[model samples]
Structures are given as C-alpha cells and as structure tokens.
Target: MKIGFIGLGVMGARMVKRFLEAGHEVFVFNRTPEKAEFLVKLGALRAKDIPSLAEQSDVVCSCLSMPEDSIKVFLDGVIPHAKSGTICLDFSTVGVDTSRIIYQKAREKGIDYLDTPVSGGPEGVENGTLTIMVGGEKEAYERVRSLLNSLGEKIEYLGGTGSGSIAKLINQYLVAVHSIAASEAMVAGAAFGLDSEQLYKLLKLSYGQSRMLERHMEQYVLDRNFEPGGAVKYVHKDVKLANQLFEQAGLTETLGKLAENSFSQAMSIGLSDLDMSAVIKPLEDKSGVVVKK
Candidate 1:
C-alpha cells in the first residue's frame, strides 16, 4: 500500500522505516523538513505539507506529539485535500472525545479513520513488537490489519470510533502508576543501602516484575543512562490524559494523580529530556538518597 506518514519523532521515524523496508511506497511530511529528509534518503517521497501528503498516498498514517496536533493535521490540513475514502490512521495517544470528533468528521468526508494508539515504546516500534489498540469501523480495521502487522505484534479492535483512545488511557494509567512505584521502590532500596542493580534484578525476578520496571527503571537506574526511550514529557502528557479520563468517567484515581504529579515534578526539575524513569531524581531529592553513580 502507498502510505503517507506524518510526524518523524523517535517512534515515528522508526515506524516509517519499517513501512519502507516492507516495500511500501511511502511519502512523508513533518513540521520540520530535516526529520523527513532521513526517510527521503531511504527512498521515501517527501510531501511538502499535509495537503501534499494527503494528495500523494492511498493511506495516511500519523504519529504526532499530541491529540490536538493530530486533529490539526487531519481536520485543518488533510481533510479537504484527502481523496474520498483515504484512510487516516492515527497512532497518537489522545483522548476519546477527540478521536470521536475526528472519526465523525472523517466519515462525513467519506474517509476511513482509525484511532489506533500504540504501546511498547521506541524499542517495540524498532522491533515490530508493539501492541496496538484500534477503534474505528470494523471493515476498516479488517482492511488495515495487514498494514498494522508491519508495526505491531499484538493488535486488537477495541470497538467504535474512540475505543482505542479509551483503552490507551487505561494503559497510560497503569504505566504511570507502575513507573512511579518502580522509582519509589528503587529509592527505598537505595536509602536502605541495597545496591540498585541487585534490587532491580531481584524485583524483576519476583512478583514486582512489570514491563516498565524491566524496560525503563532497570536501564535508567542501574546503567545510569538517562537517554529517553520514552521521554518524561511524553509520559507526563499521557498521565495528564489519564487524569482527564478518570475525572470525566467520574472516578478519582488517587494513585494516577500522584503519579501525574511525580512525573510533572520530574519535568519541572529539568528532567523532561531524560527517560521517563528519571522520576527517580525527585524521589532522591525528597529523601536525600542518591540514585546515580
């Protein structure tokens, strides 16, 4: 399938590569031309803008920074330019209401839209092991299943137009809370004079094992490599979305709020560029227990 992709961030850049490797004709657009140039070097046709991208491809996939950005690209930029029946698949993690609105507008334009938020971070995208939760038309889901296989190992059609966003919100909540727990547990171990590496290995082997603990906490805390696999700012956005969803659903998730605050605190302390696991810094500051070498 000929595809037009937008947003060439860490995850987006890697994903565009997978499509090219699979022998698909790919056109790409990014707010910055430099990011799109890497893919252009690898045989991707660069679209000058969103409208140009929409004109050039049969299906368009977007993995933008936020829900609002996704809306602007599609509604403001691509909707008028897109050929009727062009598939607009959103891989950004955004709110359900936004997804619903976009889905409706896409349908009215005779376009197919899918809210397909993904999980497993940059590692997963590079490895094609990401988990995808999709929400859109059933027919569209079936039609795009094979294309999605290029990006994820596990894919599920959650329900209607916004179900994927809802599912992703739940995923963000668990990830946020578990990530905070991982940081706190590490700090507690360090305070008690337990080696961070030993505690990480032991906990990963025990009931406290989690995807976040294994992939994020272990690397940032043990290896002291704060390079972002998923940046603190991105996770902070996800947590904020989770908090909004929790409140809208009439449930107060205290732990979710606490996790949001912790990540926000991490961002405030100039850790936004670091990996999400850098939340350990705030914990260290609060308790006066160092986590790094």
Candidate 2:
C-alpha cells in the first residue's frame, strides 16, 4: 500500500517506521522538515507538502495533537489535494462532534474518513502493540485492517463516524481519574510513613492495581524520571475533550473535572512537558513528602 503519513511527533514517527519495516511505501510530511529526516533516511519518501503526500498515496494517516490541528490539516492540506477514493484515518484523540464534522465534510469531497484514535503511548507505538479504536464505514475499515494490524496488536471497529473518538474520550476519562487516584494513593501512603516501593508491591497484589498505577508509579514516578510517555499537556487536552462530551450528553459533572483540574495544576507548576504521572508532584509538594523508591 502507498501510505501518506502526517504529524511526525513521538507516536507518528514510530508508526511510520513500523509501516516502513512492514515494506509499505510511505510518503511522510511534517510541519518541521527535520522531524521527517530520520524516517526519510529509513526509506520513506519525504513529501514536500500535504498535497504532494496525498497525490501519491492510497491512505493518508494522521496523528495530530489536537482537534484544531486535525481540522486545519484536513481542511487546508489534505481534503483539497487527496484523490477521491483515498481513505483518511485520523488517530488523534479529538472530540466526537469534531470528528463527525470532519467525516461529513470529507464525504462531500468523496474522501473516506475514519476517526481512529489510539492508546498505549509511545512504547506501544514502538512495539506495534497499541490498541486502536476505529469508527467509520465498515467497508473502509475492512480495507484498512491489514494496515492497522501493522500498527496495533488490538484494533476494533466500533460503529459509525465519531464512535472511535467517543470510545477514546471514555478511555481518557478513566485514565485521567485513575491517574489522579494513583497519585493521591501514593502520596497518602508516603505521608503515613510507608515505603513507596513496598506500597507499590502490595498495591499490585491488591484490588487497587491498574495499568496506570504500574506505568506511572513503578516506571516514572518512583524513579523520579518524569520523561513523558503521555505528556501532562496532551492528557489534559484529552480530559477537556472528555468533559465536553459529558456536557453534550447532558451530564452535570464527573470525576474527570477533578482530574482535569489536577492536570491543570500540574501544568501551571511547569510539569506540562513531564509524564501524566507527574500530576503527583503537586500532591507531593503539599504533603512535603516525595513518593519515591
């Protein structure tokens, strides 16, 4: 398959590599040309622009940071230039409504659009073990299943347009709330004079354990290396999207609001670039105890 890939960030770059390793001909583009350099060297053809990328590809897959970025890229760059039969798969975690709007507009141009959001972070991308949730026409998804399999260990085609985005929003909601809960739990355990490492071991044996707890506590938080897996800023944006979905569904409030605020506080204190687990820093500061090994 001739593949066009946009947004060469942490996840995007690695995904492109997976395609290349699978022997797919990939045309790559990024706002920053330098980001495409490594992939280009790995046998990807660097597209001068989105139009050039779209001109030669059957599938154009994008993994942007925000909804607005996806909108701008498709509206200004992708839609106008892509061939009529081309399929556009967006792996960005955007609002459901936003994705539906894009899907409708793409249909007008005869471009098949799928809201295909992904989870499992950069590590998952690198290992081709990410979980992909897809929403679009059934036929289009079937056509792209092999391509998706190259990028994810688990891929599901949910209902129509925006369903994948809705699923992703729900995923982010649970992740945010669980992350905050993990932080609070660790901080409270530390405050009560429990060793962080021992507590984490015990928690893993108990009902309180979660993937978030294992990734956040054991890898990043306890080690004091806050390098991003999923950055606080990105997670915060996802939480906001989830909150918007809740409001649209006529819900008054959710625990996501609290998680949203926790991420906001983390960002305000300059933890935006750190891992989402860094939300614990604020709790650590207030309690005057570091949750570390």
Candidate 3:
C-alpha cells in the first residue's frame, strides 16, 4: 500500500518505521520536517505538505498529538485534498465527538475514516504489539485490517465512529486513577517505614495488584526514571476528555475529575514532561518519602 503519514512524535515516528519495514511505499510528513529525516534515511518519501501527501497516497494515516491537531489535519488537510476512497487511519486519542465529526465528513467525501486509537506506549509501537481499538464502518475496517496488522497485534473493531476513542478514553481514565492509587499505596508504605521493594512485591501477588502498579514500580518509579513513556500532560488531557465523556453520558464526574486534577497538579509544577508515574511525585513531596528501592 502507498501510505501517507503525519505527526512524527515519539510513537508516531516509530509507527512510520513499522510501515516501512512491512514493505509499504511510505510518504512521511511532520510540521517540523526534520522529524521525518530518520524515516527519509530508511527509504520513506517526504511529503512537502499535507496536500501533497493526500494527493499521492492510497491510505492516509495520522498519529497526531492533540485533538485540535487531528481536526485541522483531516478537516483542513486530508479530507479536502485526498482523493475519494482513501482510507484514513487515525491513531490519536481524540474524544468521541471529534472522531464522529471527522468520520462523517470523510464519509461524505467518499473517504473511509477509522478512528483507530491505540495503547501500549512506545514499546508497543516498536514491537507491533499495541492494542488497537478501531471504530468506523465495518467494511472500511476490513479493507485495512491487513495494513493495521503490521502496526498492532491486537486489533479490536468496535461498533462505529468514535467507539474506539470512547474506549481509549475509558482505558486512559483508569490508567490515571490506578497510577495515582498505586503511587499512594507505595508512598504510604514508605512513610510508615516499610520497604518499598518488599511492598511492591507483596502487592504483585495480592488482590491489590494492577498493571499500573507493576509498570510504575518496576520500570519507572523504582529506577527513578522520570523520562516519559506516556507523559503526565497527555494523561491529563485524556482523563479530562474522559471526564467530559462521562458527563455527556449523564454520569456524575467524580473520580475522573479528581484524576484530571491530580494530573493537572503534576502539569502545574513542571512535572508534565515526566512519565505518568511521576503523578506520585506530588504525594512523595507531601509525605517526604520516595517509593524507590
């Protein structure tokens, strides 16, 4: 397939690599241009602009950073310029309304749009093991199922447009909540003079264990590696969007709001660039205890 890709951020850049590795003819573009250099070195063509990419490709894939970026790229760029019957796969995690609006707009143009939000971080991207949540027309999804297989091992097709983003936001909501809870438990243990390592080990085999607990404690928190896998600011945006989703669904926004605030607090104090596990930092500061081995 001839693939046009945009947004060359940490995960996006790597996903383009996957496309290239799978023997696809790839066109790469990023706002910065320089971010496409590595892929360019590996035989991917550079798109001078979004219109050029849209004009040249059979499939237009995007993995943008923000909801606004996704909208402007598709609404102003791809949807207007791309030919009919193009399949646009979006791996960004914008909310339901954003996805559905774009999906409808693309459908009107005869371009099939799939809101294909993904999880599993950079590791997932590189290893092609990401859990992909796909939402759009079932026929459209089937057409690109083979292409998607090159990027993700676990591809789940949800019902319709926006379903994927809805599911992704819900996943992120718990990711935020569980991150905080895990951090608190570890910190609380440390504050009371328990061994952080031993406590984490205990939690691993107990009912209190969670994937977030294992991820933070083993990979990030214990190693004191605050470098982002998924950053605080992104999680804040996701949980905030998730909170809005619940509110729109007529549920009271309680835990979601609190998680959003917690991540916001991480953002306000210059921890936004750190890993989501750094949500623990504020609590650590308050308790004067670190959750390191």
Candidate 4:
C-alpha cells in the first residue's frame, strides 16, 4: 500500500519505521520537515506538502498530538485533497466530538475516516504490537485490516464513527486514575519510611498490583528517570478530554476530574515533557519524599 503519514513526533516516527520495515511505500510529511529527513534516509518517500501526500497515497495515516491538530490537518488538508475511496486512519487520541467532526467531513468528501486511536507507545510501534481500536464503516475497516495488522497485534473494530475515540478515552481514564493512585500509594509508603522498592515488590505480589504501579515504580519513579513513554502533557490532554466525556454522561463528580487536575499540575510545574509517572513529582515535593530505589 502507498501510505501517506503525517506527524513524525515520537510515536509517529516509530510507526513510520514499522511501516517502512514491513515493506510499504510510505510517503511522509511533517510540519517540521527535519523530522521526515530521518525516514527519508531509511527509504521512505517525503512529500513536500499534505495535498501532495494525499494525492499519491492509497491510504493516509496520522498520529498527531491533540484534537485541534487532527481537526485542522484533516479539515484543511487530507479530507479536501485525498482521492475519494481513500481510507484515513487516525492514531491520535482525540475526543469523540473531534472524531465525529472529522468522520463527517471525510464522508462528505467520499473518503473513509476511521478513528483508529492506539496504545502501546513507541515500543509497541517498533515491535508491531500496538493495540488499536477502530471505529468507522465496517467495510472500510475490513478493507484496511491487513495493512493495520503490521502495526497492531490487537485491532478491534468497535462500531460507528466515534466509538473508537470513546473506547480509547475510557482506557485513558483508567490509566490516568491508576497513575494518580499509584503515585499516591508510592509516595505514602515512602513518606512513612517503608522501603519503596520493598513495598512495590510486595504490592506486585499482592492484590494491590496494577500495571500503572508496576510501570511507574519499576520503569520511572523508583529509578527517578522520567523520560516519557506517555508524557505528562499528553496524558493531561487525554484525561481532560476523558473528563469531558464523563460530564456529558451526567456524571457530577469523578476521579477523572481529579486525574485531570493532577496531570494539569504536573504540566504547570514544568514536568510536561516527563513521563506520565512523573505525576508523582508534585506529590513527592509536597510530602518531602521521593519514591526511589
């Protein structure tokens, strides 16, 4: 397949590499052309602009940062210029409303747009093990399944245009809430003088074990390395959008809001580029404790 890829940031860059390694003809574009240069060296083709990329590709894929970026890229660029019958897969984690808007716009152009938001990060992209949730016309998804298999080990077609966005937000909601809880627990244990590693080990062996706890403690918090798998700013944006979904469902108050606020604090405190596990930092500062090995 001739795949036009947009946004060559951390995860996007890795996904492009996977596609290139899988032997697809990948036409790449980025807002900053420098990011595309590395891929061009590795045998991917670089399109000068969005319309040119759209013009040449059989399918278009994007892994952008936010709702506004995805909206602007599709409405102004891909949807308008891509040939009819082209299938567009968005790997960005945006809200359901943004998904609906993009889907509507692409449908009007006779292009198939799927909200195919993904998880498993750059490592997953490299390993061809990303988990993908796809929402759009079933026929479009079926047609694209074989190509998607190169990126995802688990790809679920979840029905309707915005369902994938909804599903991804729920997954993000749990991730944010678990992150907050994990941070609090680790900090509390450390503040009270329990050996942080010992407690983490015990927790892993006990019912208290959670993926976030293990991830934050083992990979980041305990090591004091906050280089992001999922960055604080991105998680902040995702949880904020997840909170909006809760509000629309008539939820009065939720842990989603708390997770949103906590991540927001992490962003404001200049930890935005750090790992999402670094949400523990503000807690550590206030408690005068660092959960470390």
Each prediction's RMSD over C-alphas, in Å, is 1.3, 0.9, 0.9, 0.8
lDDT of 3 by residue, 1-293 (tens): 89999999999999999998999999999999889998999999999999999999999999887899999999999999999999999999998999988998998999999999999999999999999999999999999999999988899998889999999999999998999889889999999999999999999999999999999999999989989888899999999999999898898856888888889998999999999999999999999998898
User: Worst 10-residue stretch by lDDT in candidate 3?
Assistant: 251-260
The TM-score of predicted model 4 comes to: 0.98
Residue 41's lDDT in candidate 4: 95
Instruction: List where candidate 1 sits over 4 angstroms from the true fold.
Output: none
**Over the full model, what C-alpha lDDT does candidate 1 score relative to the true structure?**
0.89
Model 2, TM vs. native = 0.98
Backbone atom clashes (below 3 Å) for every candidate: 0, 0, 0, 0
Candidate 4 per-residue lDDT over residues 1-293, each given as its tens digit:
89999999999999899889989999999999999988999999999999999989889999999999999999999988999999999999999999999999999999999999998888888889999999999999999999889999999999999999999999999999999999999899999999999999999999989999988888888889998888999998999898899889998599998899999998888999999999999999999998898
In order, the Cα lDDT scores of the candidates are 0.89, 0.94, 0.93, 0.93
Write the residue-wise lDDT of candidate 1 on 150-218 in tens digits: 999999998989899999989988989999998898899889998877788899899999988887655
Better of 1 and 2 by TM-score: 2
Error of 3 at 266 (Å): 0.7
